[model samples]
Target: MRDLFEDTATAFALKTDSELERAYFLFKLIGNEPLVRIGTAVTNFAIKANLPVERLIRATVFDHFCGGTNEEECLVVADRMFEKGVYTILDYSVEGQQVENQLDYTFEKTLKTLDFVKEKDAIPFAVFKPTGFGRFKLYQKITEGEQLTFLEEEEWQRVVNRFDKVCKKAHDLDVSLLIDAEESYMQDAADKLVEMMMRKYNKKKAIVFNTLQTYRWDRLDYLKKLHEDAKREHFHIGMKVVRGAYMEKENDRAEEHGYPSPICPSKKATDENFNQVVTYMLDNLDLMSLFAGTHNENSSYLLMEQMQAKSIAKNDPRVWFGQLYGMSDHISYNLSDRGYNVAKYLPFGPVKDVMPYLIRRAEENTSVAGQTSRELTLLKKERKRRRI
Candidate 1:
């Protein structure tokens, strides 16, 4: 069988020799766990000490991972991706925001991106974290089923209002909106709010998407229940299936709280559950839309094969393959070249604000088994092909 993702030349065709070399070095650096830890700590210290490290960071990791610092800057990357037959999901990657004003700013920024994408075919979806629009503590409180004070009740209403406005805008513009999942503590409120939005905006088609992290042992069951609910209620289900981030945090929290861990006991189990959910969603394509948001080559190939067996169209609007903007160009570009619907989660924000996201990416690449090694191997293949 011809491997769909074997075209390293097409994957790296847009990269200059210097860019390719930089990526090679970056992945190599990330693959070294000790170096990554030391570098991350040093970078944090430098930033806190007000040292001049932003330029170096931007020139390397930031430039590779993020679209740019703002929407206007993101257009350059979006245009390039569109030219290559891949779509963009403009994600405002700012994190750890707590103030009401900050949350309001994040909400307006998301609406702005939604409006921006309405005029641009290059950008297919808009995404925002639930934490971006409300305080994490508020979500945790709601998840715990705690009673809210008068002021907290007012605050909760504000969060709901923000969600409604964003979902309504996406509905009006006919653009898909992805609500990102957070940690387990904060995810219940996010799931409830996202479901409410789905019920309202997904009446005719999937205008709202809720992310499902399949690494959790219960998520597959949750998906089954959500599917049943969608069928009974006569609405569409839009989901971005991922193997979940926050495994360490989720497990740590569970242990601290004297609860059994919600995460899968083994990576093999997580992979199985992830693929099973993918199969279930594809089997019910009429009632659901799916975005297979993964960097795993085997999972991507499985989805392709399943689509073939089911005779799904390559450009089906209800199905998409997604990866982070810079981490998996091999999957994104090669899949796009093969006429599959593909999108990159192009995150953008001011450098400082998006550092947490960048650090997480770096850590994830380092910690996820074989992720950095795979990237490095592909880069080397491409470089060798180019004889650079």
Candidate 2:
């Protein structure tokens, strides 16, 4: 049971010898923490200086991690992965812009992606960050319960309009929309907006899915309360449960601002929190749908066990397992091979605009205990099997 993800043949079936070696090389580089830090700094400087690093980047980490520079290019990659029975989520992962035009562009992109998801059986979900649809400060202010000036109030209305437009389009098109969670400070506002969308769009089923970052100690309680509200209001709930990505930044901001950290105190606690949330959602599957977003093998096994115990079918539409596009082939491919619903988040954008996302991937691989090693180990096993 524990060795299900240990099958290198199924895991690396899509990777050629060259692609396998590239993955090995990238994981090796990412395993060195100091090298990753230095590389991140250098990459940021080069991108800002307008140096000719795009070609280099595109040929390496960009090609390995992202689907492509745009949706058209990404479709080629998405189609290839779909051949292996793995589904994709076309994530518009560009970062670091906060203007009205950029916000509107992201909103339009979400609408466009929802149309794509509607047409393609390979793609199951459309996703976007809250800040991608509006300015971060505006969400932060609302989260803090600050009064909005007249103009600010109007701007906030545009943000709400963007959320409504995308959610409505998804519902009309019969596509599931995933709203990603961001920093804890601004998440409250996003939560309220997502709840409104869920109430409006999830009447039939979960067309609008809100992300629950279970690394936060308070999230399980939050979900329980939200469940109460949804029960009273007669609306179905959809949630994507993830261990979270912003741990270091979250702890640092909490310390600097002299507030208690919102994060669970330890990795074990966070993992337990994640499992508990999954269990709660599974226990209440009649009223909720779950997208379990994880790379951890233990959690995956736990979900598998729970499903079997509950006598749930492997192809149940109400539950899904998700991983990032490039980072967890073993889990993604093996699960898909076994007929479970699985999707990979395939991020795509211009090189410069997407550098922040790529850099964060490298840093996360570097910081997370044993993640890079696990990737390296599997890639090495596949290479040896291929005699490469």
Best model per lDDT: 2
Question: Which residue pairs in candidate 2 have backbone atoms (N, alpha carbon, C) closer than 3 angstroms, thus clashing?
Answer: none
Which segments of candidate 2 are over 4 A away from where they belong? none
Q: Candidate 1 local accuracy as lDDT? A: 0.93
TM-score of 2: 0.99
Candidates' C-alpha lDDT: 0.93, 0.94
lDDT by residue for model 2 over 1-388, one digit each (tens)?
7899999999989998889999999999999999999999999999999999999999999999999999999999899889989999999998766999999898888888988888899998999999999999999999999999999999999999999999999898889999999999999999999999999999879899999999999999999998998899889899999999999999999999999999999999999999999999999988899999999999999999999999999999999999998898999999999999999999999988999999999999998999999999999889988885
Return the lDDT, model 1, position 73.
93
Deviation (Å) of 100 in candidate 1:
0.6
TM-score of each: 0.98, 0.99
